[model samples]
Target: MDLIRQARARLAARLVVVTGASSGIGRAFVEAMAPSGARFVLVARRRELLEQLADHVRDSGSHAMVQALDLRDVEAGRAAAEEVLAHHGIPEVLFSNAGHSIARGLRGLVARPDSVTRSVAANFTGPVCHALPLLGAMCTRGGGHFIATTTVDARTSVPGWSPNVASKAGWDAWARSVAPELRSDGVATSLLAFPLVATPMLPPARRARARCAMSPEAAAEWVARAVVTRQARVAPWWLRPHELLHAAAPVLTARVTAPFSMRLVDRG
Candidate 1:
Protein backbone atom coordinates (compact mmCIF):
# COMPACT_ATOMS: atom_id res chain seq x y z
CA MET A 1 0.00 0.00 0.00
CA ASP A 2 1.09 3.58 -0.55
CA LEU A 3 2.07 5.50 2.59
CA ILE A 4 -1.18 7.44 3.12
CA ARG A 5 -3.29 4.50 2.15
CA GLN A 6 -1.29 2.24 4.43
CA ALA A 7 -1.55 4.65 7.31
CA ARG A 8 -5.28 5.33 7.42
CA ALA A 9 -6.88 2.19 6.06
CA ARG A 10 -7.71 0.94 9.55
CA LEU A 11 -8.91 4.20 11.09
CA ALA A 12 -11.35 5.51 8.51
CA ALA A 13 -14.90 5.94 9.74
CA ARG A 14 -13.93 4.39 13.07
CA LEU A 15 -14.48 5.52 16.62
CA VAL A 16 -11.35 6.97 18.22
CA VAL A 17 -10.86 7.75 21.88
CA VAL A 18 -8.21 10.37 22.60
CA THR A 19 -7.30 11.04 26.21
CA GLY A 20 -5.64 14.36 27.11
CA ALA A 21 -7.63 15.84 24.30
CA SER A 22 -7.56 19.40 25.51
CA SER A 23 -4.45 20.69 23.83
CA GLY A 24 -0.91 19.97 22.74
CA ILE A 25 -0.45 16.74 20.81
CA GLY A 26 -3.84 15.31 21.63
CA ARG A 27 -5.68 18.31 20.26
CA ALA A 28 -3.40 18.24 17.30
CA PHE A 29 -4.61 14.71 16.52
CA VAL A 30 -8.27 15.66 16.63
CA GLU A 31 -7.81 18.79 14.56
CA ALA A 32 -5.64 17.02 12.05
CA MET A 33 -7.81 13.97 11.56
CA ALA A 34 -11.30 15.46 11.78
CA PRO A 35 -11.63 15.37 8.04
CA SER A 36 -11.53 11.59 8.16
CA GLY A 37 -15.13 11.31 9.32
CA ALA A 38 -14.52 9.49 12.62
CA ARG A 39 -16.54 9.49 15.83
CA PHE A 40 -14.56 10.74 18.80
CA VAL A 41 -14.44 10.36 22.54
CA LEU A 42 -12.43 13.34 23.73
CA VAL A 43 -11.16 12.80 27.29
CA ALA A 44 -9.65 15.38 29.55
CA ARG A 45 -10.29 16.95 32.93
CA ARG A 46 -10.65 20.33 31.28
CA ARG A 47 -14.21 20.40 30.15
CA GLU A 48 -13.79 23.80 28.61
CA LEU A 49 -11.01 22.70 26.33
CA LEU A 50 -12.73 19.47 25.38
CA GLU A 51 -15.87 21.40 24.52
CA GLN A 52 -13.84 23.79 22.46
CA LEU A 53 -12.40 20.85 20.54
CA ALA A 54 -15.78 19.24 20.01
CA ASP A 55 -17.16 22.52 18.76
CA HIS A 56 -14.31 22.77 16.30
CA VAL A 57 -15.15 19.33 14.98
CA ARG A 58 -18.80 20.19 14.66
CA ASP A 59 -17.90 23.37 12.85
CA SER A 60 -15.88 21.30 10.47
CA GLY A 61 -18.93 19.07 9.91
CA SER A 62 -17.39 16.08 11.68
CA HIS A 63 -18.79 14.54 14.88
CA ALA A 64 -17.07 14.64 18.26
CA MET A 65 -18.21 13.87 21.80
CA VAL A 66 -16.48 15.12 24.91
CA GLN A 67 -16.06 13.45 28.29
CA ALA A 68 -14.46 15.08 31.27
CA LEU A 69 -12.21 12.38 32.63
CA ASP A 70 -9.30 12.60 34.98
CA LEU A 71 -6.88 10.04 33.62
CA ARG A 72 -5.32 9.64 37.04
CA ASP A 73 -8.55 8.06 38.19
CA VAL A 74 -8.75 4.28 37.85
CA GLU A 75 -12.25 4.37 36.43
CA ALA A 76 -11.54 6.95 33.79
CA GLY A 77 -10.55 4.32 31.29
CA ARG A 78 -13.58 2.10 31.69
CA ALA A 79 -15.93 5.06 31.69
CA ALA A 80 -14.38 6.36 28.50
CA ALA A 81 -14.68 2.99 26.83
CA GLU A 82 -18.29 2.69 27.82
CA GLU A 83 -19.01 6.19 26.58
CA VAL A 84 -17.53 5.43 23.18
CA LEU A 85 -19.27 2.07 22.91
CA ALA A 86 -22.59 3.67 23.74
CA HIS A 87 -22.56 6.22 20.96
CA HIS A 88 -20.15 4.65 18.55
CA GLY A 89 -18.55 1.22 18.49
CA ILE A 90 -15.82 -0.17 20.79
CA PRO A 91 -13.40 2.51 19.64
CA GLU A 92 -11.74 1.04 16.63
CA VAL A 93 -8.77 3.14 17.78
CA LEU A 94 -7.53 4.19 21.20
CA PHE A 95 -4.90 6.89 21.72
CA SER A 96 -3.53 6.87 25.25
CA ASN A 97 -2.03 10.34 24.96
CA ALA A 98 -2.46 11.53 28.50
CA GLY A 99 0.93 11.77 30.21
CA HIS A 100 3.09 13.71 32.65
CA SER A 101 6.57 15.04 32.11
CA ILE A 102 8.68 16.26 35.03
CA ALA A 103 11.70 18.48 34.60
CA ARG A 104 13.19 17.15 37.86
CA GLY A 105 16.28 15.11 38.32
CA LEU A 106 16.62 12.05 40.55
CA ARG A 107 17.04 14.19 43.67
CA GLY A 108 13.87 16.02 42.79
CA LEU A 109 12.03 12.74 42.43
CA VAL A 110 12.78 12.03 46.07
CA ALA A 111 11.45 15.47 46.95
CA ARG A 112 8.28 15.08 44.88
CA PRO A 113 6.41 11.85 45.21
CA ASP A 114 3.37 13.38 43.57
CA SER A 115 5.15 13.89 40.28
CA VAL A 116 5.99 10.23 40.16
CA THR A 117 2.41 9.38 40.96
CA ARG A 118 1.06 11.58 38.18
CA SER A 119 3.68 10.40 35.76
CA VAL A 120 3.00 6.76 36.43
CA ALA A 121 -0.73 7.25 36.43
CA ALA A 122 -0.91 9.02 33.10
CA ASN A 123 1.91 7.25 31.34
CA PHE A 124 1.55 3.65 32.40
CA THR A 125 -1.40 2.43 34.42
CA GLY A 126 -3.83 4.87 32.83
CA PRO A 127 -3.53 3.19 29.45
CA VAL A 128 -3.77 -0.24 31.04
CA CYS A 129 -6.82 0.64 33.08
CA HIS A 130 -8.44 2.00 29.92
CA ALA A 131 -7.31 -0.31 27.13
CA LEU A 132 -7.76 -3.75 28.70
CA PRO A 133 -11.54 -3.73 28.71
CA LEU A 134 -11.71 -2.73 25.05
CA LEU A 135 -9.26 -5.39 23.89
CA GLY A 136 -11.62 -8.35 24.02
CA ALA A 137 -14.26 -6.49 22.10
CA MET A 138 -11.81 -5.24 19.49
CA CYS A 139 -10.41 -8.72 19.00
CA THR A 140 -13.86 -10.15 18.68
CA ARG A 141 -14.68 -7.47 16.14
CA GLY A 142 -11.49 -8.63 14.37
CA GLY A 143 -10.15 -5.11 13.96
CA GLY A 144 -8.95 -2.26 16.14
CA HIS A 145 -5.91 -0.14 16.94
CA PHE A 146 -4.21 0.94 20.17
CA ILE A 147 -1.61 3.69 20.18
CA ALA A 148 0.16 5.59 22.91
CA THR A 149 2.80 8.25 22.67
CA THR A 150 6.10 7.48 24.40
CA THR A 151 8.88 10.00 24.47
CA VAL A 152 12.51 9.73 23.42
CA ASP A 153 13.31 9.07 27.09
CA ALA A 154 12.30 5.41 26.96
CA ARG A 155 14.99 4.89 24.36
CA THR A 156 17.62 6.72 26.47
CA SER A 157 17.94 9.01 29.45
CA VAL A 158 19.07 12.52 30.30
CA PRO A 159 19.50 14.59 33.42
CA GLY A 160 16.26 15.69 35.12
CA TRP A 161 14.21 13.13 33.23
CA SER A 162 14.39 9.91 35.19
CA PRO A 163 10.71 9.77 36.07
CA ASN A 164 9.58 10.41 32.51
CA VAL A 165 11.98 7.78 31.25
CA ALA A 166 10.83 5.25 33.79
CA SER A 167 7.14 5.94 33.35
CA LYS A 168 7.30 5.77 29.57
CA ALA A 169 9.37 2.62 29.89
CA GLY A 170 6.46 0.99 31.64
CA TRP A 171 4.04 2.38 29.08
CA ASP A 172 6.20 1.17 26.23
CA ALA A 173 6.41 -2.31 27.65
CA TRP A 174 2.65 -2.42 28.10
CA ALA A 175 2.17 -1.56 24.42
CA ARG A 176 4.84 -4.00 23.23
CA SER A 177 3.48 -6.87 25.31
CA VAL A 178 0.09 -6.57 23.72
CA ALA A 179 1.24 -5.70 20.23
CA PRO A 180 1.76 -9.24 19.07
CA GLU A 181 -1.51 -10.42 20.52
CA LEU A 182 -3.40 -7.59 18.89
CA ARG A 183 -1.68 -8.19 15.58
CA SER A 184 -2.56 -11.85 15.61
CA ASP A 185 -6.21 -11.08 16.15
CA GLY A 186 -6.36 -8.58 13.25
CA VAL A 187 -6.20 -5.79 15.79
CA ALA A 188 -3.17 -3.53 15.44
CA THR A 189 -1.24 -1.77 18.19
CA SER A 190 1.65 0.64 18.12
CA LEU A 191 3.63 2.95 20.38
CA LEU A 192 4.52 6.16 18.60
CA ALA A 193 7.84 6.48 20.38
CA PHE A 194 8.45 9.97 19.20
CA PRO A 195 11.60 12.04 19.25
CA LEU A 196 11.55 15.44 20.91
CA VAL A 197 8.75 17.48 19.41
CA ALA A 198 7.11 20.85 19.99
CA THR A 199 4.46 19.31 22.30
CA PRO A 200 3.92 20.90 25.72
CA MET A 201 5.73 17.91 27.18
CA LEU A 202 9.12 19.29 26.10
CA PRO A 203 11.53 20.75 28.63
CA PRO A 204 13.55 23.78 27.56
CA ALA A 205 16.58 21.75 26.65
CA ARG A 206 14.40 19.30 24.80
CA ARG A 207 12.69 22.25 23.22
CA ALA A 208 16.07 23.53 22.12
CA ARG A 209 16.46 20.22 20.35
CA ALA A 210 13.50 21.42 18.32
CA ARG A 211 15.80 22.64 15.65
CA CYS A 212 14.44 19.37 14.34
CA ALA A 213 11.26 19.28 16.38
CA MET A 214 8.22 18.02 14.57
CA SER A 215 5.20 20.24 14.81
CA PRO A 216 2.38 18.81 16.93
CA GLU A 217 0.21 19.09 13.82
CA ALA A 218 2.68 17.12 11.76
CA ALA A 219 3.10 14.54 14.48
CA ALA A 220 -0.66 14.26 14.75
CA GLU A 221 -1.01 13.67 11.05
CA TRP A 222 1.58 10.89 11.11
CA VAL A 223 -0.13 9.19 14.05
CA ALA A 224 -3.55 9.39 12.43
CA ARG A 225 -2.21 7.89 9.25
CA ALA A 226 -0.43 5.11 11.08
CA VAL A 227 -3.69 3.87 12.55
CA VAL A 228 -5.17 2.82 9.24
CA THR A 229 -1.91 1.98 7.53
CA ARG A 230 -1.13 -0.38 10.40
CA GLN A 231 2.62 0.08 10.46
CA ALA A 232 2.15 -1.30 14.03
CA ARG A 233 4.55 1.31 15.54
CA VAL A 234 6.29 4.41 14.25
CA ALA A 235 9.06 6.83 14.99
CA PRO A 236 10.84 9.16 12.64
CA TRP A 237 12.32 7.11 9.84
CA TRP A 238 15.63 8.59 11.01
CA LEU A 239 15.21 7.51 14.65
CA ARG A 240 15.90 3.89 13.93
CA PRO A 241 19.62 4.56 13.77
CA HIS A 242 19.67 6.40 17.09
CA GLU A 243 17.47 3.70 18.60
CA LEU A 244 19.92 1.10 17.39
CA LEU A 245 22.76 2.99 19.01
CA HIS A 246 20.91 3.01 22.33
CA ALA A 247 20.06 -0.64 22.03
CA ALA A 248 23.65 -1.60 21.46
CA ALA A 249 25.13 0.46 24.29
CA PRO A 250 22.88 2.27 26.72
CA VAL A 251 25.59 3.56 29.05
CA LEU A 252 27.42 5.31 26.26
CA THR A 253 24.21 6.69 24.87
CA ALA A 254 23.17 7.95 28.29
CA ARG A 255 26.51 9.68 28.75
CA VAL A 256 26.13 11.35 25.39
CA THR A 257 22.57 12.41 26.11
CA ALA A 258 23.34 13.74 29.59
CA PRO A 259 25.43 16.47 28.04
CA PHE A 260 22.42 17.61 26.04
CA SER A 261 20.70 18.75 29.17
CA MET A 262 21.66 21.88 31.11
CA ARG A 263 20.85 20.25 34.44
CA LEU A 264 22.40 16.94 35.39
CA VAL A 265 21.46 15.19 38.60
CA ASP A 266 24.87 15.14 40.32
CA ARG A 267 23.61 13.21 43.32
CA GLY A 268 22.87 9.49 43.30
Candidate 2:
Protein backbone atom coordinates (compact mmCIF):
# COMPACT_ATOMS: atom_id res chain seq x y z
CA MET A 1 0.00 0.00 0.00
CA ASP A 2 1.05 3.62 -0.54
CA LEU A 3 1.90 5.83 2.44
CA ILE A 4 -1.47 7.52 2.56
CA ARG A 5 -3.34 4.22 2.48
CA GLN A 6 -0.96 2.75 5.05
CA ALA A 7 -1.55 5.68 7.36
CA ARG A 8 -5.27 5.40 6.89
CA ALA A 9 -5.17 1.70 7.58
CA ARG A 10 -3.21 2.18 10.75
CA LEU A 11 -5.32 5.05 12.08
CA ALA A 12 -8.75 4.03 10.84
CA ALA A 13 -11.26 3.95 13.68
CA ARG A 14 -8.46 4.44 16.21
CA LEU A 15 -8.49 7.10 18.86
CA VAL A 16 -5.79 9.75 18.40
CA VAL A 17 -5.20 12.52 20.90
CA VAL A 18 -3.57 15.70 19.61
CA THR A 19 -2.63 18.67 21.73
CA GLY A 20 -2.30 22.12 20.14
CA ALA A 21 -5.05 21.06 17.76
CA SER A 22 -6.64 24.45 17.42
CA SER A 23 -4.11 25.81 14.96
CA GLY A 24 -0.84 25.38 13.10
CA ILE A 25 0.65 21.97 12.47
CA GLY A 26 -1.62 20.27 14.97
CA ARG A 27 -4.72 21.51 13.20
CA ALA A 28 -3.27 20.54 9.86
CA PHE A 29 -2.46 17.06 11.16
CA VAL A 30 -6.04 16.53 12.30
CA GLU A 31 -7.34 17.61 8.91
CA ALA A 32 -4.87 15.38 7.09
CA MET A 33 -5.75 12.36 9.20
CA ALA A 34 -9.51 12.89 9.28
CA PRO A 35 -9.95 11.02 6.03
CA SER A 36 -8.28 8.06 7.70
CA GLY A 37 -11.43 7.51 9.78
CA ALA A 38 -9.69 8.19 13.08
CA ARG A 39 -11.45 9.53 16.16
CA PHE A 40 -9.57 12.57 17.51
CA VAL A 41 -9.38 14.25 20.90
CA LEU A 42 -8.37 17.82 20.13
CA VAL A 43 -6.69 19.67 23.01
CA ALA A 44 -5.91 23.35 22.89
CA ARG A 45 -6.52 26.67 24.65
CA ARG A 46 -9.02 28.13 22.21
CA ARG A 47 -12.60 26.84 22.32
CA GLU A 48 -13.84 28.58 19.21
CA LEU A 49 -10.98 27.42 17.04
CA LEU A 50 -11.23 23.89 18.40
CA GLU A 51 -14.98 23.86 17.73
CA GLN A 52 -14.41 25.01 14.17
CA LEU A 53 -11.81 22.30 13.61
CA ALA A 54 -14.14 19.75 15.20
CA ASP A 55 -16.87 20.82 12.81
CA HIS A 56 -14.54 20.33 9.89
CA VAL A 57 -13.53 16.88 11.13
CA ARG A 58 -17.17 15.82 11.65
CA ASP A 59 -17.97 17.11 8.18
CA SER A 60 -15.22 14.90 6.82
CA GLY A 61 -16.89 11.94 8.57
CA SER A 62 -14.40 11.55 11.40
CA HIS A 63 -15.01 11.72 15.13
CA ALA A 64 -13.65 14.72 17.06
CA MET A 65 -13.81 15.80 20.71
CA VAL A 66 -12.41 19.13 21.77
CA GLN A 67 -10.83 19.64 25.22
CA ALA A 68 -10.27 23.33 25.42
CA LEU A 69 -7.89 24.47 28.17
CA ASP A 70 -4.52 26.13 28.52
CA LEU A 71 -1.80 23.53 28.80
CA ARG A 72 0.22 25.91 30.95
CA ASP A 73 -1.91 25.04 33.91
CA VAL A 74 -0.55 21.87 35.46
CA GLU A 75 -3.79 21.02 37.23
CA ALA A 76 -5.83 21.62 34.13
CA GLY A 77 -3.54 19.43 32.05
CA ARG A 78 -3.82 16.59 34.55
CA ALA A 79 -7.56 16.96 34.77
CA ALA A 80 -7.92 17.07 31.02
CA ALA A 81 -5.90 13.90 30.64
CA GLU A 82 -8.09 12.05 33.11
CA GLU A 83 -11.19 13.37 31.41
CA VAL A 84 -9.95 12.16 28.03
CA LEU A 85 -9.18 8.74 29.44
CA ALA A 86 -12.60 8.52 31.10
CA HIS A 87 -14.41 9.68 27.98
CA HIS A 88 -12.43 8.14 25.11
CA GLY A 89 -10.44 5.33 26.68
CA ILE A 90 -6.70 5.20 26.06
CA PRO A 91 -5.81 6.81 22.76
CA GLU A 92 -4.03 4.61 20.26
CA VAL A 93 -1.89 7.56 19.25
CA LEU A 94 -1.05 10.49 21.50
CA PHE A 95 0.42 13.37 19.53
CA SER A 96 1.90 15.66 22.18
CA ASN A 97 2.32 18.60 19.79
CA ALA A 98 1.66 21.65 21.96
CA GLY A 99 4.44 24.15 22.83
CA HIS A 100 5.19 27.77 23.66
CA SER A 101 8.20 29.89 22.73
CA ILE A 102 9.74 33.08 23.98
CA ALA A 103 12.86 34.90 22.84
CA ARG A 104 14.64 36.72 25.65
CA GLY A 105 18.20 37.50 26.63
CA LEU A 106 19.62 37.07 30.14
CA ARG A 107 18.81 40.68 30.92
CA GLY A 108 15.26 40.34 29.75
CA LEU A 109 14.89 36.99 31.43
CA VAL A 110 16.05 38.45 34.68
CA ALA A 111 13.57 41.26 34.32
CA ARG A 112 10.70 38.93 33.50
CA PRO A 113 11.21 35.61 35.22
CA ASP A 114 7.65 34.56 34.47
CA SER A 115 8.77 33.89 30.91
CA VAL A 116 10.76 30.94 32.16
CA THR A 117 7.85 29.58 34.19
CA ARG A 118 5.46 29.99 31.28
CA SER A 119 7.85 28.34 28.87
CA VAL A 120 8.52 25.42 31.16
CA ALA A 121 4.82 24.99 31.83
CA ALA A 122 3.81 25.00 28.19
CA ASN A 123 6.64 22.93 26.80
CA PHE A 124 7.65 20.56 29.59
CA THR A 125 5.55 20.25 32.73
CA GLY A 126 2.19 20.73 31.07
CA PRO A 127 2.65 18.19 28.29
CA VAL A 128 4.20 15.69 30.64
CA CYS A 129 1.40 16.12 33.12
CA HIS A 130 -1.19 15.65 30.44
CA ALA A 131 0.51 12.61 28.92
CA LEU A 132 1.28 10.70 32.12
CA PRO A 133 -2.25 9.44 32.68
CA LEU A 134 -2.77 8.36 29.09
CA LEU A 135 0.69 6.85 28.98
CA GLY A 136 -0.06 4.67 31.97
CA ALA A 137 -3.35 3.58 30.44
CA MET A 138 -1.68 2.91 27.12
CA CYS A 139 0.92 0.77 28.86
CA THR A 140 -1.82 -1.20 30.54
CA ARG A 141 -3.45 -1.75 27.17
CA GLY A 142 -0.08 -2.83 25.67
CA GLY A 143 0.06 -1.01 22.32
CA GLY A 144 0.24 2.68 21.44
CA HIS A 145 2.26 5.40 19.76
CA PHE A 146 3.41 8.67 21.32
CA ILE A 147 4.64 11.42 19.06
CA ALA A 148 6.26 14.59 20.42
CA THR A 149 6.70 17.70 18.31
CA THR A 150 10.01 19.21 19.36
CA THR A 151 12.29 21.67 17.62
CA VAL A 152 15.62 21.36 15.85
CA ASP A 153 16.73 24.21 18.08
CA ALA A 154 16.65 21.84 21.03
CA ARG A 155 19.76 20.16 19.64
CA THR A 156 21.86 23.27 20.11
CA SER A 157 21.52 26.34 22.24
CA VAL A 158 21.23 29.79 20.76
CA PRO A 159 21.37 33.26 22.27
CA GLY A 160 18.04 34.93 22.98
CA TRP A 161 16.20 31.62 22.83
CA SER A 162 16.97 30.16 26.22
CA PRO A 163 13.41 29.73 27.43
CA ASN A 164 12.19 28.14 24.22
CA VAL A 165 15.21 25.94 23.65
CA ALA A 166 15.62 24.86 27.25
CA SER A 167 12.00 23.87 27.72
CA LYS A 168 11.85 22.02 24.41
CA ALA A 169 15.12 20.32 25.20
CA GLY A 170 13.72 19.16 28.51
CA TRP A 171 10.74 17.62 26.72
CA ASP A 172 12.98 16.02 24.13
CA ALA A 173 15.21 14.55 26.80
CA TRP A 174 12.24 13.28 28.80
CA ALA A 175 10.74 11.57 25.77
CA ARG A 176 14.01 9.90 24.85
CA SER A 177 14.62 8.76 28.39
CA VAL A 178 11.20 7.14 28.53
CA ALA A 179 11.32 5.61 25.06
CA PRO A 180 13.13 2.40 26.00
CA GLU A 181 10.80 1.76 28.92
CA LEU A 182 7.75 2.56 26.85
CA ARG A 183 9.01 0.25 24.11
CA SER A 184 9.16 -2.62 26.60
CA ASP A 185 5.49 -1.98 27.29
CA GLY A 186 4.65 -2.17 23.56
CA VAL A 187 4.29 1.60 23.35
CA ALA A 188 6.36 3.43 20.76
CA THR A 189 7.66 6.98 21.00
CA SER A 190 8.64 9.21 18.09
CA LEU A 191 10.10 12.66 18.28
CA LEU A 192 9.88 15.16 15.44
CA ALA A 193 12.75 17.66 15.68
CA PHE A 194 11.26 20.18 13.34
CA PRO A 195 12.93 23.15 11.74
CA LEU A 196 11.31 26.55 11.42
CA VAL A 197 7.75 26.18 10.17
CA ALA A 198 5.44 28.84 8.86
CA THR A 199 3.00 29.02 11.76
CA PRO A 200 1.56 31.57 14.14
CA MET A 201 4.19 30.46 16.64
CA LEU A 202 6.71 32.55 14.78
CA PRO A 203 6.75 36.31 15.05
CA PRO A 204 5.19 38.06 12.06
CA ALA A 205 8.54 39.41 10.91
CA ARG A 206 10.28 36.08 11.33
CA ARG A 207 7.45 34.29 9.58
CA ALA A 208 7.73 36.66 6.66
CA ARG A 209 11.51 36.19 6.53
CA ALA A 210 11.30 32.42 6.82
CA ARG A 211 11.55 31.63 3.16
CA CYS A 212 13.01 28.17 3.76
CA ALA A 213 10.53 27.15 6.45
CA MET A 214 8.05 24.40 5.76
CA SER A 215 4.35 25.17 5.62
CA PRO A 216 2.03 23.88 8.37
CA GLU A 217 0.58 21.30 5.98
CA ALA A 218 4.05 20.13 5.06
CA ALA A 219 4.99 19.80 8.71
CA ALA A 220 1.85 17.75 9.27
CA GLU A 221 3.11 15.32 6.65
CA TRP A 222 6.15 14.67 8.83
CA VAL A 223 3.88 13.90 11.79
CA ALA A 224 1.84 11.53 9.61
CA ARG A 225 5.04 9.84 8.51
CA ALA A 226 6.04 9.38 12.13
CA VAL A 227 2.63 7.94 12.94
CA VAL A 228 2.92 5.51 10.04
CA THR A 229 6.59 4.56 10.46
CA ARG A 230 7.01 4.86 14.27
CA GLN A 231 10.56 6.10 13.80
CA ALA A 232 12.52 7.21 16.86
CA ARG A 233 13.11 10.62 15.37
CA VAL A 234 12.27 12.73 12.31
CA ALA A 235 14.52 15.71 11.62
CA PRO A 236 16.17 17.67 8.85
CA TRP A 237 19.25 16.01 7.33
CA TRP A 238 21.62 18.73 8.50
CA LEU A 239 20.48 18.67 12.13
CA ARG A 240 22.66 15.73 13.15
CA PRO A 241 25.79 17.34 11.80
CA HIS A 242 24.87 20.63 13.39
CA GLU A 243 24.34 18.88 16.70
CA LEU A 244 27.72 17.18 16.41
CA LEU A 245 29.43 20.49 15.78
CA HIS A 246 27.85 21.96 18.89
CA ALA A 247 28.75 18.91 20.95
CA ALA A 248 32.34 18.96 19.74
CA ALA A 249 32.88 22.62 20.48
CA PRO A 250 30.08 24.08 22.52
CA VAL A 251 31.92 27.22 23.59
CA LEU A 252 33.25 28.00 20.14
CA THR A 253 29.90 27.31 18.47
CA ALA A 254 28.04 29.50 20.95
CA ARG A 255 30.57 32.32 20.65
CA VAL A 256 30.47 32.21 16.87
CA THR A 257 26.67 32.16 16.60
CA ALA A 258 25.77 34.49 19.45
CA PRO A 259 26.14 37.67 17.40
CA PHE A 260 24.08 36.43 14.49
CA SER A 261 21.42 35.04 16.78
CA MET A 262 21.13 38.32 18.66
CA ARG A 263 21.03 40.21 15.42
CA LEU A 264 18.09 38.16 14.25
CA VAL A 265 16.35 38.73 17.55
CA ASP A 266 16.90 42.45 17.23
CA ARG A 267 15.49 42.36 13.74
CA GLY A 268 12.51 40.37 14.89
Please write out the lDDT profile of model 2 over residues 42-138, one tens digit for every residue.
9999999999999999998889999999998889999999998888788999999999778888878777888889899999999999999999999
Query: Candidate 2's C-alpha lDDT?
Result: 0.90
- Over 4 Å off, model 2: 264-268
lDDT of 1 by residue, 5-113 (tens): 4444444677788887897889988887665567788888889999999999878656788889777787867777766666577877888888777656666777777
TM-score of each: 0.88, 0.96
Residue 125 lDDT in candidate 2: 95
Error of 2 at 34 (Å): 1.6
lDDT of each: 0.75, 0.90
Candidate 1: minimum summed lDDT over ten consecutive residues — where? 1-10
Q: Report the Cα lDDT for residue 119, model 2.
A: 90
Please provide the root mean square deviation of candidate 2 (C-alpha atoms, Å).
Answer: 1.6
